[model samples]
Target: MKNTKKLYYLIGILVLVLLVWMVNDTFTQPGVDDLEMEFQEVAVYRNENNTGPIKRIYAVVVSDTLWHEMEQYGKLMPHTKYGNTQVYFFEDIANAPEKINAQSPYFDASLNPFCIGKYEKKAMGEEHFSKYPFR
Candidate 1:
């Protein structure tokens, strides 16, 4: 009887630990609004192929050039296994692309000069980020 009681106590302690962990995880996670910089999403694209690798792209206009925050925004984007994700940042919505795709040279070359930053997550899960002085 004593051993059974001890086992029950242990199980109860584990349940309490799990509940605390869950609540902590839920509240500590960051969302889009958690970003310190002001930004607007101008465009988004997804290949929408469930049978194969998915591809996602985003174009955003940011009020300022904050490289770390831009990277954080990219990380917040949805990604899938064996998939790719890319983000392009600009200073003005007028220069940001209204449409993007999985194709190479995702956006028009003419807009390159207006891009302020770029972030990419390759299919193999590799990440790349760069900031341009195109302001």
Candidate 2:
């Protein structure tokens, strides 16, 4: 009887700890609206095949150049195991590409000069974020 009571006490403590963690995580996570910078999504692309590695790409336009906010936006993007995610940031909507694909040069060459930043997450989980004047 004593052992059973001790086990119950341990389980109750574990449950309490889990509840606390869940609440804290739910409240502290950042959402798109939580960002201070103003931006608009122009385009998004995701491959159809789900059995293997997936690819996701996004193109957005921002009111101003804020590298930190761009990085934050990239991090907020959804990712999958053994998948690739990319984000292209532009300063003007007219210059932003309306469509993007999983190709190496994701957007049209004509739009290159207009791109302000780029973010990429490789299949192996490595992340790269670069400001344009891309080299």
Runs in model 1 deviating more than 4 A are 2-7, 133-135
lDDT for model 1: 0.89
Q: Model 2 clash pairs? A: none
Over 1-135, each residue of candidate 1 has an lDDT whose tens digit, in order, gives 999999999999999999999999999999889989998989888886998999988899998898999999988889898999988999998888888866877888889899989998988889989888345
Residues 17-50, model 2: lDDT tens digits: 9999999999998987888898798999999988
Candidate 1, clashing residue pairs? Answer: none
Q: TM-scores of all models?
A: 0.85, 0.82
Worst 10 residues of 1 by lDDT: 126-135
Report residue 99 deviation for candidate 1 (angstroms).
Answer: 1.9
Score candidate 2 by TM-score against the native: 0.82
What value of lDDT does candidate 2 attain over all alpha carbons?
Answer: 0.89
